[model samples]
Target: MSDSSTDNEASLHQYQDIQYSLKQSNRKTTSLFIERDGSVTVRAPLPYDMAKIESIIEQKRSWIYRNLAEWEDLNRVQVHREFVNGEGFLYLGRNYRLQLVDEQDEALVLKNGRFLLRRDHVDSGMEIFKNFYRTKGLDRINQRLTHFAPKMGVTFGSVRVMELQHRWASCTSKGDLNFHWRCLMAPLAVLDYIIIHELAHRLYRNHDAKFWDAVDKVLPDYQRHVSWLRHNGAGMGL
Candidate 1:
């Protein structure tokens, strides 16, 4: 496979103390992002020049630095796990030890406060665990959505739990919601926050004041969960 982009040309550009990749497209507004790996990218309208893009970057300098610092802190506690007995895995913010069983009809099951895995599936344990999360996540997320949708005054389409990479959850233009399977590893409250965050997107596409206000109406103390995910996200992995 090869990489191709018709919307924008990517090149490394620097302004003062900031170095970033500028992506200009037909977008109506310029948006900045700190990628999952901590690289800076700015997407601006096609008509904007380098000077204008740099100015936008300068305006958001403090925000960029703050999020980059948090990204650094997140990576510091990155977790490494092995598919052996007594190794702990996270489920709803709780740690459950792993136990390999010689015989089981299913590849994995949570029983007696521990995760029981079939011994033969050790090599493909990651996918098995992801399947477990995705399966369980769909039921839980849909249930929560049902409870919260009316409160938020929105009707959603289908809900799915899959690999969303760096994002916790996303809402489509058609009102469908997709969540990362890793979300099932967080606390129930945090998971609700994730759901509400996406549901709010059903009303507003951007993270503006109105979008946040919609979230505040449902969960008053949502910032703590945001901070929790930022601080603890690294450990929520295989």
Candidate 2:
């Protein structure tokens, strides 16, 4: 770990086997989370007490363990990408391999059971792929949200597709929707889940019981999609 991460990591108890990352900010509440990579994090108000934090961790031990187990299971499925010939790419729930060709008007396109790309643009293939998704995601996500928003009782004023570092999608307080272009690679059902998730946030603004209930009303099998994202998210990008 770097010095900054060392600053972030701490122990619940000095003699215990478990370690957690600590982040102190001017937040309203203290929360513990397990990241996709299976690392534990504790976010708290500034100037927190060691004993109080330990007590909270002790109380939520069961929830933490269960979530950690799920994380391990999801992470156990290896998902990675390689920039080479015949490399597989995911688009709308289907896998397509790369087929480099010398003649292509566009930078990239999906055709005949493969992603056709210009041989000269192989060095920039990842960007071309991202642009392909970004271009398609704009229309696809917008259409889906337009179809579902009225039924869900949420209206988004605008939608944008771009690169997101930490989240699949987000809804702004001003009623704008932003989705990561990578989301276009997931199954349509999973994409719906992501859309519903952001839409639900427009109403609740937090992931509480009410938010999940809203999601459940929209997609009853939302957990399956959530699990799919957790397990396969590692491979969604180049």
Candidate 3:
């Protein structure tokens, strides 16, 4: 995939400097987010000026730099795993060891405190793990959405588990929800945070004050989960 993001840099307050990629969109208000690759992206409505863009980034300097540092620190550590006996795999916030079997009855299954995978699946351990997450995650995510959607005053559409690279979850404008299978690795509370985060988007589309206010209504301590994901997201992959 090629990134079409271009860098936008200008002067800042008190001799500080902010450089970011400006993505003009149909949305109202300016929204800034740091990408997984450590690039800054700012989305603003069209017909905006450079001075205005700089001011918006300036106002959120603390947030920008704080998350930038978090991004840098996240990529500093690496998580590697070999699909052998006693090797650990994360599921629903706990590490479960792989228990490979010599039967080809199925691709993957979790039973009796271990991830029971067929011996032939060893070569494609990543796919086996991904399948485990998708098959299991679909059930868990739907049940949770049914419980939380009513409180949000919104009816959720089809909830699917997939490979949503670079994002935890996404809610389509049409009311459907899609969650990354990797999200099944996080704790239940963190999973709820991801669910509530997307459901809130059905009401407020941007990360503005009103958008956060919607999220705060459900999960007041959402920041902790956000921090957890930011710091530990790199390790979530297989």
Q: In candidate 3, which residue ranges exceed 4 Å CA deviation?
A: 1-62, 65-79
C-alpha root-mean-square deviation, candidate 2: 6.5
Candidate 2 per-residue C-alpha lDDT over 1-238 given as tens digits, one digit per residue, 9 for 90 to 100: 2223334445342315346777764576888777665567787765666677677788877555434432333223355666577989999889999888989899788999999888999888778888999999999998899899998998887889998756677678998988888789999998988888888888897555787789899899887887787667766776
For model 2, what is the C-alpha lDDT against the true structure? 0.76
Of candidate 2, the 10-residue stretch with the lowest lDDT total is 68-77
In order, the Cα lDDT scores of the candidates are 0.83, 0.76, 0.76
lDDT of 1 at 196: 93
TM-score of each: 0.73, 0.73, 0.72
- Supply candidate 1's per-residue lDDT for 227: 73
Pairs in clash, predicted candidate 2? none
Looking at model 1, the pairs that clash are none
Model 3 lDDT at residue 185: 93
